[model samples]
Target: MQQSEALCPKFEFAFSILSRKWTGLIIQTLLPGPKRFREIADMIPNMSDRMLSERLKELEGEGIVMRTVYPDIPVRIEYALTEKGKSLESVMREVQKWAQQWVDC
Candidate 1:
């Protein structure tokens, strides 16, 4: 057992991203399809506009979400998960299953 591992046994880089507040739920919400800003905000009940904007920016910085702005009518904007983000789907699903199984006990 190494000194570093002993001191921080659960210091995982991937889990760091997964552990962020609302990050898991946000990723789950986007699994169905891409969405506009307002659409996402509306769907996530009680999610403040400011917090959503900030989290989206953070996810974008982390390469999990891609934001696109269109130049056509109404200047549409949309957000979608990147390949990196899609990779989390299965991980989240397994976690969901485990949680439900254990939490019910």
Candidate 2:
């Protein structure tokens, strides 16, 4: 029998980011467009503000998410996906399609 090859490091890194709790949901939620802190928190139920904040920061650091701050009277802030993150749209769509067919809620 042929030997199985080891997992690719890039795939491992991507999986590591996606496997984290709340990461996928956060990315999915931002797929439509940019959203404020409260908007994201509201869209994803059961995710604490602290956890949301933490996950956003991690995604931002990974260059997957872009955080914008508008210097207004109240200082509006929004989170959106960068080009690198937006490239995952097809991947996300595929996962959603697969889940719809195979995943039982």
Q: Identify the candidate with maximal lDDT.
A: 2
Q: Find the 10 residues in a row with the least total lDDT in model 1.
A: 2-11
Q: Please list the residue runs of candidate 2 whose C-alpha ends up more than 4 Å from where it truly belongs after superposition.
A: 1-4
Which residue pairs in model 1 clash with each other? none
Q: Give candidate 1 regions above 4 Å deviation.
A: 2-11
Measured against the true structure, the TM-scores of the candidates, in listed sequence, are 0.82, 0.93
Question: Evaluated with TM-score, which candidate comes out highest?
Answer: 2
CA lDDT of every candidate: 0.87, 0.94
What does candidate 2's lDDT look like per residue over 1-105, in tens digits?
Answer: 334576678998999999999999999999999999999999998999999999999999999999999999899999999998898888899999999999999
Write the residue-wise lDDT of candidate 1 on 20-47 in tens digits: 7788888888888898998888878878
